[model samples]
Target: MDVNRRNEMKKVIVSVKLRDILIGILIFNICIVIFSLIVVGVNKGNRQLKYGNTENKQIEHNNSKVDLDLKKEKDTILNKKIDSCINLYLTREKRIVKLDLEQYVLGVVSAEMPANFNIEALKAQAVAARTYAVCHTKHLVGGGCSLNANADICDSVHCQAYISQEKRMKTWPKKERAELYNKVKEAVESTRGQVLSYDGELVMNPYYFATSSGKTENSEEVFKESKPYLKSVESPGEEVAPKYKTQFKFSNANFTTVMNSQFKGLNLNSNIIKDKINILERSQGGSIKQIKIGNITTTGKMIRKLFGLPSANFTISFESTNIVFNCKGYGHGVGMSQWGAGVMAREGKKYDEILRHYYSGIEIKTLNYK
Candidate 1:
């Protein structure tokens, strides 16, 4: 072959090989991009399948539907009215401070009942606390705190137990403080301005306590005052309460000494303590109404107060070395039982229904004070 022609053929071959190499490289780059797109699409699908629908369904099942916009608007108007009208006297601080009524209700509900209780139970407590506050407020009823005449209501449990936001935050577990507080806030705000009333008047005493011995007492039996709304009623399903049943053991000497101290001239002897102690009368609700000890006849309420018993619904038994007082329920057993309310809530009862059940013939009324 001639030298020039051979050189031209070699250059053409080299150009063709370079073109083939460039086409192969382009195909490889296209494949890489396609694989990356497929990988990203798969990951996105997996994430949606794993998290999105499941989380939404869980939320829907766990929480009742709430209209956040409506709640916020109502809260704003309520807050303004309460800020102008309500004030509380803190016994510990010994000062009267003005606060929103709903805020005070939140504190009382949180302090008075377990925050972990069902939402309905908390709502019942919120309404009862609000009614108590309204009935006692000097601004509304001219009834001021008995302890301090300068204030509408006192913070102590004598009125209602209250804990400030700062103290509540400190008291609840760090991991759960915010969530628990939100639960309580929801309960208080959801039932805002609702109170218990009988015959167009705020119920004078919407009393409540920790637990009941299967039934609540008539007001006449416990408080010596007859309240039509506070009549005895069967309160069931409270066996799960922590204080449902309790025992306090007292040595014979200790029991005798305490009894003598409370009722003078009794001269109760340790050996004859069991013989001298006699239960004379019991209320319809199963709490001791009157008892005879030695030569003295005393009311069960007085004995309960003197010995620091949980309730008057107690049975006395003589042991070998100690006198055992087996008590059923906590508190006076005269009003709504908190544990009973919780059980009702879990059984799907609404807050208003629970309140009506406890306070006979009472109406749940919305406050119109502005």
Candidate 2:
């Protein structure tokens, strides 16, 4: 009985030892799996952190670019404003007027064109006047138009007709002054910084006139230089001008004396004056190109100046004791016709259209000093 009991005890002890060994193996496998999971989780966290840093860098770079663009835009605008400011000389006052370029343009438009004209016409005038000022400023830099050496421009018809607000008020009716002033001011403000350009450059000469003689004249015909944009164009419906058809009469003796004195080489004989007068050539626009008086050939421009004629489009005839001059228009007939612009504006043309109608192949550009 003692041997049997000892065998049972030995069997129990072996079974218990086997069970402890199996538990130990299972615990080792579980520890291996836990270590692998921890390594994988740590790698994932590292990747996320790197990606987050890259994303933040991209956002910061985008923000920096936006700020740089805004700053550049602001600088450009500031430069433009500074460039637009020009110095003007009021010749009548004999003083320099430090006015904004747009304000000077306003004064020019008001004094140059009638305040009662169409809004579009007024805008066109404003652009033209501004362009004229810019061209003069450039000319001033190049040592041209030296009448006012210390000025960007002079305030005269020689440059551009300019009237101060105080003078304009004095000239206008007390009740209507405010309304007229506002009308001009609106036109200038609406077309601020606008100018006419040809071939990507500003036009040096922006000639304008009160009326055209049926058509506008070529620049070559009037100014001896052909400007492609100032080519002759039809300007109809200017018959409504107050002095469209003016008749000037002078005594034969007086006319002969004036002609003889004006024409440097001409010696006039009163008896043969009627026979010697001749219109040698006419421009395509029908203005007298050249005239022959006795032995001297002179331009119609000279004759117009000598006789105080309204325009070069005139027909001279000897009628008994007087020389009759039947004139058609009232200016140099070079570029923009104010009356034609008015008629076009009245007929529902915009300011740009009016400008294109008068100035051929031109671009209306806002002067960007930047």
Candidate 3:
């Protein structure tokens, strides 16, 4: 090689070594500083831990690690309440739950049905509801307390269910009921936030809101404490049939007024009437003849019943079995008829669409946990 090239190469090598040495020395100094800081901190922490003000001391968290372990303590507690729901996994292997945050939020807001539900199906339903709330709350799972097994889902506040062991199993399936319960419990814990929650409070969904004497549901005026406690039920019927098969004074007027609350003076539109008018006892009453809307004949017994009434004071449209003229407020005379939101989702209906319909002002989002 040439002398100039060799000199240049030698100079570059020397410069490189000098740079590395300087960098190494700087790194060593930083490490020493960090070590000294850590030792000083540890000494201070140990002193406080061993002889801190006794009166002001807390439960004596051994270390920062214990202070961050609130999630396990909470899980130990909630697990005890619902021991039957089916198990689910965050992944295919089933290491963690699939529905976490949804469970927590829902747990604080809902509760299980009567003890005769299909646990697996109930768990699936809880997952779906979690899917719904996850969207609405804008919160995801697997983020520690932000989303964990600290929540309860598969509850009645979000959906109605039978309560009381005997009453629940009376008509529900045996195998299916157990399966649903077990599946739900597992699914709820497998994922993050699978229960009802609101603000900072962990709302335990008190099932079955009570109403007036014969009326069990008056959403606005619920029997706060009498909430249902059972877990799941395999079968659910259209509104539980009245105890007495035959009514002593059954009339369309009474059905619309007392049962449904419909009348000409009601001034409610066709949509409102449709929302509230349900046939709870179709197989056990007289047939309704006709109904008129502004002198126009509407379809079925609806229009006919409207024609005869004084518009303000309702009258019995009919009364008998096989075609019970039941004038109920709301179409799905069954469970949790969303006469309110049902009027909305119909403009465009999807599964999520139906969810937003019943649950007031909520969103729809999917789950993703790592």
Candidate 4:
């Protein structure tokens, strides 16, 4: 009778174990189903875009059906990468040194300023960007440029970060492949997110300094490497270039003439605007003559219109450079030049050449996702 009791107890335990196993399988299936449904719903939704301001939520567009199919393919094959993107970014010393592929792409892509940009350029930028994303999945654990994860300033300012612009514009300059790749890769690898606020909102990219006349205004002003004040460092070497005639030297008459009309294109009093320009001189080291409301402060020469910011603040300093006013590059003279890159790309050069022109001596590597 005891032996019978033992056998019966064993049978009961086996049944309970089987029941637990079956329950576990059911729960797993349910989770999978729910997860799959959520994914489908999300895929169906359009990717919303917000520009300089978000009060007005503007959706750039929804991708094509073909694009969606590709996304699906990528989603299936690289779900691991996508999941990694959703995970919390890792940081060290308050810098976002670590990011998944998606976050990396987000950081770099968001930094681009491609307004009515080129398809080929977009593809090229994406291809180069993706290569870095895949390569530096885990190893890109540190940032070098303007990035403070907690500050929301990561990759925003001093860093060559992504800004919203047209993809088609990238093709205009025509840069090489290697150079383009390097530039994009450098930005992705070095930038970290900051947590600062600008205009009551977060400052996405915050570090900005001008390199007027090719010297960081501060660097040249502080270090008088040249005999004359007007001289500037031309090539990337220690020696200073010869000083040239400055536009500031307007035969005293022309100075007064341009000064009167320099702020001419716009409707602003030269006298009132002159006051603002004077402030930038003591404040910015660059001598100023023309000042306009709503001028993009970064790239002083380019009217805010080209950047799509019709109303911007910009102060143009008429510094002495014997060279013609017709310019080669764009922007605040502090960071990367897409125009320069485009020129190189158009010339059938590599991305590396483009990167070297903009940034100096930055290493490229791939980080593991694990």
Candidate 5:
């Protein structure tokens, strides 16, 4: 029965066992591959769901953060290109001090606009002040302070008001100084190296004032020069400003004396002042343009300066023995009104939106030195 039959059987048994083991290994390998494919598919779907639809993809919140970071980085690079110094003349100190342009912008923003204003409004003011400084930079643009040839600008309202950080700290209450300064600094830094330009040229005159009489004046009406961007525009929601409406009263004798002193050869009777004074022409923004008094035609601006009035948008009224001038708004009423900007900011307008509203046909461009 025998050795050959036994050896054949043993070989058959071994071959069958080997085939079973091979099949089992193949099945295990297939299961491993299938499990990996399933895991990968699940991960892909989760990624898609987290990101958004593939056809119309939406950014995740983190993506927005990344975009903001990139924008900040870009702004940092732009600011680095313009890290130049400015020579600012201190009018009270009668000295010229040089500082970084961005720092100067910070000072100007802190000085020109109230620190408690909305951040967007402060940003708008920062850009405007930066534009003014860059436009008047002596070496950069061939413009300088008229009073001081050695200085690029003066810390006077005639230019753009600027106060050092030390001075600003002193001006504000002790508890509010640090917070206010940080707010101003954030505004300037957020808009670093940005300026307003009209038709590819920097805005030469970015004039702004405290308030307006419902609307801003045209450049031609206020400065006698036509500026396309500085046209008449409505400035609403400024009635809440402190200087919205003011009054100046002068006795008939005092009024007559003041008028006669400015307009020589004019003899006016105090009793008939109301009848003799007449407003002949008014600007589109309701600012008095021309007025005649005792056969003398004078400009409203001249009268405003002579009498130290807040603005030229005034109405005349006779009160017993006194001549009363009711003035609406303040400053020159030719550009962006600070109070108006605050209103816009409160209504959720962005800084660029506020700037574009006041300065028409302008672009907010990043400064490039090269």
Candidate 6:
């Protein structure tokens, strides 16, 4: 009976221990499952944050590209506006030619002035040419060249000498053509869209001429009209011009015939004509303002034309073989003298200084074409 009791006790104790061990294993497995679930949830949240950041960066890059495109579009629109305002010009060939304003000025400069002149002198010429063009457009009131009613100005010096690029290329030597063209083009571009004004008004007629004898003439003296800007001013250093001093000799018969033909009322006695030709008055520029031939009193301009004299600044003398006219200067001796400007530029005078010296009380301003 004792042996039976002991065996029953041993079985009960073993069964209890086995149940505790099973319970411990079940608890450990449950804890491992809960930890695994928590770790997986945390990993999923980190992946979503990384994805969101990558999308935000892509959106910022896309926005930057859109901004750059908008800027480029704006720049193109601005360029068109500038072109529309400046690319309309009329040509003498009865044609409406489209040319950039600066380019037109370059052609005019190349034609109207020597290419070898100083850069500052060329710049001054460009500004003057531009102002002249703008002024003509305003004064024309939509009118055009007298010869061509549809043209703004002729390609001749009668208006402003303008040579086309094709003509320039044909006329200039092949090696020198591009260099000469660039020189003039640079002058125009450097002073692009610049014009001259006086008392807040655009200068309509800025006259310029070749070499002056010693001084520029007053507008009243030359044109019979006073212009405040065009005043008598001493122009030095023009004596260096090649034709600054020239002489014209005419045979007695030729001189008499020319004089009689021009003035029908006059009968010239060749023997006494030398004594009769006398300068009565001289302008401030030392040009012959008035002269007396026999009993006819006329302006020096008439004598210059009748005798084919280069300028009105001359002294008549009788040579053993012919009547000689010793002349000075080449043109009307009015406004800005080309040779004078060259000299001034060589002396380190800027374009503005040169212009102010010639055109008194003037202002250099930007083109205000509406």
Which number leads on lDDT?
Answer: 5
* Colliding residue pairs in candidate 6: none
Better of 2 and 4 by TM-score: 2
Q: Please, what are the lDDT tens digits per residue for candidate 1 over residues 147-209?
A: 888888888878889988889889889999999999999999999898887765667789999
Higher-ranked by lDDT: 2 or 5:
5
lDDT of candidate 6 at residue 235, scale 0 to 100: 88
Candidate 1: deviation at residue 121, Å?
Answer: 0.6
What is the lDDT for 306 in model 2? 89
State residue 44's C-alpha deviation in candidate 4, in Å. Answer: 75
Q: Between prediction 5 and prediction 6, which has the larger TM-score?
A: 5
Residue clash pairs of candidate 5:
none
TM-score of every candidate: 0.76, 0.75, 0.26, 0.30, 0.77, 0.72
lDDT by residue for model 4 over 1-370, one digit each (tens)?
6999999999999999999999999999999999988876775574332334333433222345555654454333332322234212233334344444445554454456342222233333443444433322222222223233333223443333543224323553565534544444444344322112212221112222212333322223323232121222222221121221122222323333443454444443433443333223221333221333423122333333333221122323443421112221123333233433343455565655434343333222222243
| Model 5 CA deviation exceeding 4 Å by range | 1-83
lDDT for each candidate structure: 0.86, 0.83, 0.35, 0.36, 0.89, 0.78
What does candidate 2's lDDT look like per residue over 1-370, in tens digits? Answer: 6999999999999999999999999999999999989886996776544455779867888999986764554334323543665567777678886677888888888888889999999999999998888766632223224667767777876777887788888989889999999999999999877888776666667889898888999999989999998989998998999978899999988988988887676888777788888999988777899998899888888889888999999998878888899999899998899999998999999999989988999988776653
**Which candidate wins on TM-score?**
5
Q: Candidate 6: which stretches are off by over 4 Å?
A: 1-98, 138-144
Tell me the alpha-carbon RMSD of every candidate. Answer: 24.6, 22.8, 23.1, 24.1, 22.6, 29.4
Candidate 5 residue-wise lDDT at 368:
63
lDDT of 6 by residue, 50-158 (tens): 5557798678889999867644543333223333122233444445565656667777898888888899999989988887665554222232456555455566766
Q: Which stretches of candidate 4 lie over 4 Å from their true place?
A: 1-99, 103-111, 115-330
* Model 5 per-residue lDDT tens digits across residues 190-296: 99888987766667788899999999999899899999999889999999999999999989999899888877889999988889999999999999999999989
